[model samples]
Each structure stands twice: as C-alpha cells, then as structure tokens.
Target chain A: MHVRGLVDGQEFLVKHANGLANGVSELQHLFPAGSNVEDSDALPVIWEKPEEFAAAIDKAVAATQKFVAAAESGDKEAISSAFREVGGSCRGCHDTFRVPQD
Target chain B: MIASGARRLAIAAGLLLQGAAGAADDDLIAQGKYLIHAGGCITCHTEDADDAVPLAGGYALQSPFGTFYAPNITPDKETGIGNWSDEDFLRAFYEGTNPEGDAYFPAFPYTAYSGVRQDELLAMKAYLFSLEPVRKEIPEHDLPAFMSSRLAARAWQLSYFEPARFEPDTTNSSAWNRGAYLVRHLGHCGECHTPRGTLGALLREKELTGNPEGADGESIPNITGDRKDGIGKWSLSDIEYFLDIGMLPDGDFTGGSMSDVIEDNTSHLTPEDRMAIATYLKSLLPAD
Candidate 1:
C-alpha cells in the first residue's frame, strides 16, 4: 500500500531512494500472519497458500534486483522496461493476495 | 491475332472485377476482426484457458443477477450462430432479443449494444462466419427462481431499457465523437465501471466514477476527473498505457477482470483510439 501514493511516470518523489540496491523491496513490507494489523489489504490467501506466496515474493525480489541494476546503469531504455517488469512482479502476487480497492 | 488480343483484354477486365470484390470481402473481414476486439467479444465469449478456442464461448460472468455462461458464438450449425441471418444478429443487439424472439437476460449488456449500427453488426457477423467453427454448448445460468424466467428479462427490458443509437455531439471534436461511440456502445465500459441501480440498470448520473459491486464481486475504480477518488492526476499517456498493459498509474500493475480486458480488448486498439478514449474519459465531470 505504500506504493499506492507513488504515481507512475513521476518517480521524483521517491527519486532519492534510487541509490538503494533493492529500492522496490525497500518500500515493500509483508507483515506476518496473525500480527496485530488493521486495515491491511493483504488477503488470507497469503497465509493459506504459503508456497505460492513465497514463490511470488521470490519473483518480486529478483525483479527488484534487476530494476536496481537498471536504474544504476543510467540506461533510460533498460530502466523503463525493468521498472515495468517490477510492477508486473508485484501484480503477480497482488492479483491473488491483495484485496482490491474501490 | 487481333481477335485474340481483344479476348485477352476482356479476360483482364474480368479478373480486375473479381479482385475488387475479393478485396472488399477481405477489408470487411479485417474491420470485423478489429470491431470484435473493440466490442470486447473475445474476453467474455472465450473461456479462460491456455488452449481456449477463440469465440467458442464458455466464459462465465458473475453478477448480482446470476452467473451467466456465455454460449457458443462460433459458426457451428449445432451449437453456434451459424444459422443466424443478418437481421437475426442485428435484432439480438438492437432489440436484445434472440432469433426466436426470447428476451436475453440483462447480463448480456445489450443495453449498451443497442446503440450499434446495422452495418457494423453485419460486418461483425461476416467476420464470425469467416472463422473456423467450434461446437460448444454452454451451461444454463444459476439464477434465483424469481428471475429465472425469460418473462422476467422481458419485463426488465421494458421497464429499464431504451433502444437508442449513438448521436454524435456535433460541437465536440470528431475524435471525441468516435470515443463516445466506442465507450458508450462498442466497449461498454459502463457495464462494469458505472454503478447499477436495484434492477441492475446502469446509473447514468454516476457514470465512470466507479462501482463498489462489480464483476466477480470485485470493486471497480473510478476514472473520472476527481483528484482524490478518480484518475485526475493521470495524463493521457498514463491512461493509454494502463489500457494497453493493465499497469496502474501507481508503479503497480492492475489485475483481476481488467487484466483480461487489457489483453483481449484495449491492447488490440490503435494508439489513436486509445488516446481518444483517454480524452473522452478526461472530459467527464467529476462526481463524489
């Protein structure tokens, strides 16, 4: 949900975070199941399907790592595609595990 | 030899006429294929599977009304629309009736389809006929007894529906007009995006602001000009790219039913058409 406020095309707000090797994951935090969390968008499937959820996280981690490298490389074209792929990786998990917002 | 030359010229003329006719058929078929995407036929009609046949039609749509299983639309004689004439196809959309005069349930979204012109419907039919036919029988809808009868659908149509064609707003730009036609009729974005009334009729005043209860019991987001509730911050390119690939203005990609729409419908549209849709969406008044 932290990324919800960060609009696409305008990454200037979080531009300072670019130096981090895993900037994408730096913003992502998955609370443990049964934690005292309220108003969380994470669905029960995240806990129920542990293996699938873990696999999804692995994919996202790799995507974030690639994105970090691309951003640091200073290659505009590569950065754009990597950035989009990172979003795709997040969506792969969100589709099943996140409660859709109205 | 002079007589032979005249015969050869006659043969050449005959071939030219035949080529022109063949080209017309090809053009009609091509346009129809594009319209199929614009009309969102593939997304609903084709079942969700890696090997699903195009337009074989077993996709299910979950609504407050019931779970509607889209029937086979292929040109197969046994289970598809092979026997439907041009008029039969037109009546289905324009009047929301089957070839046998039975009223279809509101799940079909023909209320929005009513605005489509006759020629386009025929072209769409022509395209369907050109495809390889598949014989697939669909399941009956699971509906409550009160709404199960065809009479119920007929009554609903009489009360809440009006068959209307698109009227271009003369004052607006041509692109805007095209966008209006595509969004209002062909694309039928309002079917999911627009909030529905008690009887499942779309609420015109609350158009495109969003729906809490949408397809598959998921909430659909607002795309109006409201900064807080809608996509007011998104530029035209943002909306176009979103439609193209299901990526949200947020660095995250959108998923669920909309992902299917992006893959089957908007992704296939030309950049100009996507931009037109973006322009039209941006022009709507913001509502709370």
Candidate 2:
C-alpha cells in the first residue's frame, strides 16, 4: 500500500487495492486522539460540510468498492473507472487539507 | 519458332514479376518511414542540436541506472545497422539482444517492442535502410565497471526476459487492440513510465504506475487515476487533445520529454489511434 517507490504494474494494482481497503480503516484515524469525536484529526467538518466532504468520501468508498470488484473480475473498464474514483477522493481530501505537490 | 516465342514470353513474365517485387519493396519502405516516425525513432536517435542527423543516433539517454548511448542506426555500412540482415534486425527487436549476441540494456525499450507485428518491424527496417547512410560513430556506454559486462546482461535477460508477440484481446474492440499494440510496442511508453530494478530491468509488476526518476531525472507522473498523484482529473478528451497537440486540458503547453514524444510519435498517429491510446491509458485504475 505504500506509494513512495512502487513501480511494477501488477504490484501497483494489488497495492492500490489494499490501500483502498486501508483508506476505509484510516478514515477513522483522520480524527485526533483523546478529543471528542468532533475534535478528531479527520475533521467532523467532513460530516459538517455534508455536501462536499461527505459526498467525496461516499464517492471514494464507492469507487474503491467498484475498483476491488472490477479488479477481481478482470474488467479493465470498471477497474479504470474505480481508479478514477479513488483519485477523486484523494484529491478531494488533499484539496481540503494537503498542499499540492506539483 | 514456337519454342523461341514461348521462351521470350517466359522472360518477359519474369521481368514483370521482378518489377512488381521492387515496387512492393518501395511501398514497404514508405510504410516503414511512417511507422518509424510513429515509433519515435527520431526522438531518441537525433540530437537536439543542429549538428545531428535524423536517425543517425548518438544521443545520450540519461537514466537513474546509467547513461545509455543510442547507437547510430542509420544505414552507415560500418557504424550503423546497414550491414545487419533482416534476421539480425528481428532478433535485436524480438529478443532485446544485440547483433553481437549480447543482451541489450532495457534502455533500448525492446520490452514494449516484444509485441510488435513482424511486418511492422520489417517496415521499420526498410525505412531505416532507405535513409541516407550516416557515418558518425557513437561512443560506448559509460556504465559502472560492475555493470558493464555483457555476461551480466545475459543473466538479466535470462531471468527477466519473456519474448512474446502482441496478442489481440478478442473481447475488446479493434480500436482497443490497436491502442494496446501501439502503447505496448510502437510507443514503448512503459520504458519510460515503468520503474526499473537495480539491473535496469522493468519491474513488470509495476508497469506504468509511474517512475519518480526516469529518463533525465524527470518525475514520470503516475498515469493511473490517483487523484492526488496521478492524472485522475483528466477526461478522455483531455488525454486525446494532449496527445494530438501537446496541450493540457488547462491550455498549458508541455515543454519537456512529453512535448518531444507528441511531436515525434502521437502527433503523427491518426486521431483515432490517439483516442485509442487515451482510452487505454485512462482505463488504468489509480493505486490508492
């Protein structure tokens, strides 16, 4: 799932699949430790701004699910679409909090 | 008198057949010229400066592993591939092994070429043969001593190499198959975008995910739809337009290796071909 140095295509897809699964797990980690649920790092603002953050997360989860399914079925078209969804979620999250690297 | 007439007629027919063969060769050579342009031979072989001759080779390709000298492939009888037979040319491409039986460094991009059609490769040969022979001599590669031995290359090929041809995916549309063939063979895009291992072999598993340090220290971006790290924002039209005119969807013009790529390869391809490439590329799911 580590993105830093991966280059192989098969491994990339496998890693990506794991990462999407992990993203679902990590969604909980976005919140800060020891604070109220509202004060977590992942920002309940996601829930607060239901239209933006919630929609983004929903799309990401859906994409990840589709990605896993398509990849499993060997459907390239569906896999590609799922990958785009995953990208959307990452961009949406970064746009909210992370700086652009390029 | 009848026997004499029959003999004359036979000679005339033989002459006609020879003429037809010559014309066919000429037509094949012309087709090869077109394929060569699409194959991006000029981009790597020709130096950027005015002194360089197209397809004469001698350009230095920089990679994280080491510098690879694109050899003179022009028809120079002594320095180039001019003296190489059709078999030699085919083996070089199909096997990624050099004429000397030494395994070529993957820097040659033969992995992508492994899928090319036989006729297409022959056409490339024909086009290359038709060029005005250039006599410029290129230098040997400056690899580290440990990596310089051809035996090491032989071992590398033994372990990693798998010679194969382009197998059309029967379920896919013809456009998709053509795109796959072009991307995998003629385009050899994976040679740049895919990451290589310590010995300069492509990590086939990581094909086209992206290479941070590829040709010339450029960060070859992940083409997969990783929104944060890849081109997930791009539409199919965006991809096609970029290939067609080297313009990004945002209207910015590219200036580096991609610019040269489009100019030499994708730009010359038909619009339908470009769209197919776009379609195939856009189809890769971004790694999370």
DockQ for every model comes to 0.31, 0.02
Best by TM-score: 1
Q: Give TM per candidate.
A: 0.83, 0.70
Candidate 2 residue runs with Cα over 4 Å from true position:
A1-102, B1-15
lDDT to native, each model: 0.81, 0.73
Candidate 2 residue B226 Cα shift, in angstroms, is: 3.0
B-chain TM-score, every candidate?
Answer: 0.95, 0.92
Write one digit per residue (lDDT tens) for candidate 2, span B1-288: 999999999999999999999999999998898789778888998876667888888889987767888999998999999889999999988998877888987777787787788899999999899889999898888787877988877787888888867889998878778787878788888887777787677777777878877777666767777777777888877787667655555544454577668767787788788889877777677863
Q: Which candidate should be chosen as best, given lDDT against the real structure?
A: 1
How well is each residue in B1-288 modelled by candidate 1, as lDDT tens digits?
A: 999999999999999999999999999999999999999999999987769998999888888878888888999988999999888999899889999999998788899999987888888998999999998898888888998889999999999889868999999988888888888999999998999999899999999889999979999988788999998888888888788656777656777777778778997999799988998888888875
lDDT score, residue B170, model 1? 97
Structure candidate 1, residue pairs in collision: none
